[model samples]
Target: MNSLVLIAVGLLGILSGWFFYSRFIAARIYQLDAQFRTPAHEFRDGVDFVPTNRYVLWGHHFTSVAGAAPIVGPAIAVIWGWGPAFLWVVLGTIFFAGVHDMGALWASVRNRGQSIGGLSEKLLGSRARWMFMLIMFLVLLMVNAAFATVITNLLIQFPTAVIPVWGAIVVAIGIGQLLYRAQVGLLWPTIIGVGLLYGLILLGNAVPVALPAEIFGLSDRVVWVLLLFLYAGIASTLPVWMLLQPRDYINGIQLFVALGIIYAAALLSAPTVVVPFINDQVPAGTPPIAPLLFVTIACGAISGFHGLVSSGTSSKQLDRETDARLVGYGGAVGEGMLALAAIVCATAGFATLADWQAVYTNFGAGSVGAFVTGGANIVSQGLGIPAGLAATILTVTAALFAGTTMDTGVRLQRYVIQETGAITGIAALKNGTLATLLAIGFCLAIAFGAASDGTGGMVIWPLFGTSNQLLASLTLLMVTVILARLGRPVVFTLVPLVLVLTMAIYALLLQIGTFLGDQNWTLAIMALFILGAAIMVGISAVTALRQTGFSLLAHRHPAE
Candidate 1:
């Protein structure tokens, strides 16, 4: 098929969804009101709670939630075929992800910008809320470990990305200080920051940074992982505006530019899809597309993780409650666009079928590797950039995505730990520094604890998808309950909730069977735990719904 046709269809679908579907959701389902005060204004503290421009907040939310999942997930799932992947990415983003994200943000904003874990207590009972926090703690540990490992491996794979990656951090810190401390306008400073980032990319391409093969008897990758954790530990504890907001804004701009180049290349080069529309060559014993495909393409399509970013960070920064649709739902559209770009690249960027198959032969690192290379190929072929330079550009872009997400994951995990501790009456765990250290330690242990092959994230990646979807299901379920309580039509959130919950449970069961058959007791046990937590939360939500039959419950306003 012509690449333009595929690109046009995907882009059109997403745009139309944003214009019509999302607007309907905002007006009818969410019923956002600008008259209400926002938590950012009510709790204006310069630290975590500060009102932010909608555009700037959108940048932070999008980048934090985008991470490498959208790129990696769709890249991997296309192995099933382009058609199924494309359908899920488009439809799922519209109905599932956008609604879930917008709903989560709405819930948080209405309740004093509380995190999802905090909102659960208000919407459901205390038992479900605590269970939600426990699940959040576990899921975020996996998130931090996986993203840290992924970034480390990317830097090692593309040494040129290291200097640019670290350089951007320094630039971000400088920009943050100037903006927050000096109270300078962001226009000129942002331009300079972005210019410096691109300039460093050029220099990094020339003089790449790479650690030696061994350090203190540890492999280079291991050493890099440790260094990454150290950086994350510090970054997560810092004030939000100082690093997280400015850094993610810069990264988001780079991603947009990258997307522009890749899409232009797809149009100019117009490489045809060598892989079939529907691939029947999936590995033996792999689960069918019904549930497995849904989980595999979680981030780009619909992710529970987006809710965490929405409630945990973005909610506190939003200037108005009505902006949730634009930031939360619109950000999901941006992600869907990225996913579509990946689909176009994966399906048509390669020159031949053999070349495509070689990269996509398996699911682990190769899925990520294929996207970097395929994207590079598109840019190089279309923009006439040298192959090496093109690869360096995309590689650096991927690293930035991973780095931003890893630290943010740790930061959110720290919040969950502190929240859990306070709820459970564990004083020590509520200490900020201690919570951060514990979060980082657990991430390091998991990342380093995998098989000797050191593909810990890859080993746990399948479970991560299932867990991620389960989280989304629970978040949507809460939204459904909230809507029911408010006496609004619950069909919008309820339908997606049912579909996602069924898919997640089905996928978990299949994973458990496979892990047991392969004698991988660890994954099997984790799967069981995820299933149990999910069931517990599900039961709680259903019971709450039954007891309160769509009656309006007294709600806490943002001013409270």
Candidate 2:
């Protein structure tokens, strides 16, 4: 298959989904109102709840939720074949991810920017709400911890990315001041920031920086992880405008440019996909592709993490209730495009079947490495960029994206902790500083405690994938109940809810048995806990639905 085919088809599907499907969702299903008083204005604190431009908010959301998953998940899942991964990426983005993300945003915005977990108290009862928070902690912990390790490893692997990765922070801080404090418009700040960022990338490519093997009596990886958490802790405490919003906006723009180049490379070079549509070579011990594919390709398809980001942060910054469609659903579309890029690159970048087979010796072999290597090959071949520079560009892009997600993940975890404080009557945990420290403590403990190399968090990726889907299903379940109470059509959200819930439950069971067979007691125990909580949530959800069956609440002016 020609690479251009994938590019054209992916773009066509994404554009149609954004133009037609999301509009129908916004107007009919979500019933967004331009005049509705958003929580951003109602609770404008300049910290977490500032009214933002929809484009900037979308940028923040797109990057925060995009993370490394869209690339890693789809890149790895294509081992089952590009056909399955490609179909799931496009179709799931349209039907599953878009709705789940948009509905979570709308639901939270409708309820005063309450997190999905917070909304659970009323929708599913306090017990379910507490359980929702637990799942969130686990998900966010995995994200922050795992992403920190990802960045550190990337820094080690591509030292050329180090300067640009770190320099991007200074640029973000400057951009933040320009937009928020300097009283300037976005145009000049954007031009200067993006120019400076790319300049750093060029400089980084020329002058690569690698740390010594050890620093301060610790390995470079450990030190880098610690520094990353410290940065996240500080970044989380800052106002959104200062770091999160501007940084994400800049990173988002850079990524879009990167996507454009990679897609153009596909058309320009027209590389043939060397891999088969469906692989006959089943890697030993590879799980049955049925449910594992869904979990493996979570974020790009349908992620519970997207729901968390939507409700936790994006809902708080919604400029207008109407912007939810663009920021929420549109963000998912952007991620879908990223995943499509991963699929196209991973399958088409290789020159021959033997080359592809070398990397496919195992199920988990080709992830970030595949995307980066393949993307670099395409860019170098088509765009005439040096191979080394192309690799730096891609690696810097991935590392920066992972960093922003880590920043947001820590802040989201702090919100859960402080919310816990409010619920448990522990005032200190509500303090942002203490809450941040505690969140970091938990993340670091998971990282270093589980693995001495500070890579322990990566072990829970299997749990993270399944539990993330479970949370999405739970979020959709809440949205379904809300629709049932309001007496609107429930088929859209309802169907996806059932599908994701079934897959998640099935996948978790499979993982548990694998863990037991391998004597990996930790994941087995955590997986069981998540499974039990999911069951409890399911029962409570049923009772909640029964209590609100067939009500006739008006959609136009929902009660606050």
Candidate 3:
């Protein structure tokens, strides 16, 4: 089948979800109130709690939750065949991710902007909250430290991307000043910002910037790591309007433009999908497609991490309660679109099935590498751009994604720290500056302390997939409990909650065995411990759901 077939179907289904189903959920279920006061206004500190334009908030939430996962996940999941991955990315985003993300935003907005973890404490008990928060802290640590290395390596490999990638920071700051300080409309700033960013991309293509072998005796990679962390620390602490909002907003626009390039390329080129619809030929020890596909493609289809971004940052910036449908659910749809594009690039870029098989020797063989390689080829062929320049554009786009995710992760980690301090009664931890210091300090330690070369952040990378999905499941559980409390329909949240928890736990168990076989005690023990914590939280959820004001707790009745 042609790659355009997949793009056409995916777009149709995704748009239908946004237009028809999301409207239904908004009116009949979520009942979003346009006049309702949002926490962005209620707690407008301007630092973390500034009320934002819905378009800008959607951009922030979309890019923050995006990372490299949506691209990586679908690209890798093409091993099973593009069909299954395509279905999951499309259907899962609409039913599972869209609802979960929107519900988390709504629940948080309704509860005075408490985090999903904080909501867990009130509904599922303190123990559950502790478990929930621990998982999130580890996930954030994985993101911040690992992404610093990811961005550094990308800069080193694609020197042409460096200029545009760093140049975007200056452009975003100017946009922020125009939008907030000058009080101008978003239109001019968006157009000018995107134009300048792409111009940087063109200039970068002309004058590639390469770092020296060493900067003051430290390796170039180490210097980049330090610089990245330093920037994240300061930028994350700035007011939302100053940096985070505009930076992510522009990056989001750039990414959509990139996606549009790929989609148009697929439409024009009409490249044949080289991979099989279903790979009946077994690749030796490939894991069963059942639960593994779900975990493998978490972010593109559904993610627990989205819940963190939603409740942690997005809910705080929501200008109106009604905007949750657009920001929360719409952000997820944006991710789904990215994933669909990934599936197309991975499957159709190669000349034949044999070419794809050479790369897909195992379950995790193809990720960002496949996405970039395949995407550059398609872009070059369809747009008449040189291969090297096309590659640079895609590379810079991917690096920007990782950078924005790190920004959000650093800030979210700080939130986790402050929340932990309040719960533990540590006055110092509750202070914003202190907590941010602790957050950055811990990430730096993980990067430098654990390894001589500042690559220790990768040690915990293996656990990110399972732990993240489990956390998503728990967030759904939190939402389910909240819906129960409100005496509203529970089916929307409840079913996805059950499905994600099952798949994530099953995948976690599988990883434990793999870790044990590989003699990776560090991963094995950590996975086992996380599994135990998840079970406890699940039990807590069950109890919370059962004890709900009698009948509601028993799910409307014992015999229902």
Runs in model 1 with CA error above 4 Å? 363-365, 451-455, 550-560
Q: Write the per-residue lDDT of candidate 3 for residues 206-245, one digit (tens) a residue.
A: 9999889888899888988998998999888899889899
Best by TM-score: 2
Tens digits of per-residue lDDT for model 1, 148-211: 7788888988998888999999998988888878888878777888889989888989998899
Error of 3 at 83 (Å): 1.4
Model 3, stretches more than 4 Å misplaced? 549-560
lDDT values of the candidates?
0.84, 0.91, 0.89
Write the residue-wise lDDT of candidate 2 on 21-128 in tens digits: 999988988789999999999999999999998988999999999999999999999899889999999999999999999999999999999999999998888999
* Error in Å for residue 301 of model 1: 0.8
Best by lDDT: 2
TM-scores, all candidates, are 0.95, 0.98, 0.96
lDDT of 2 at 285: 73
| Model 2: residues with Cα > 4 Å off, grouped in runs | 550-560
lDDT of 3: 0.89
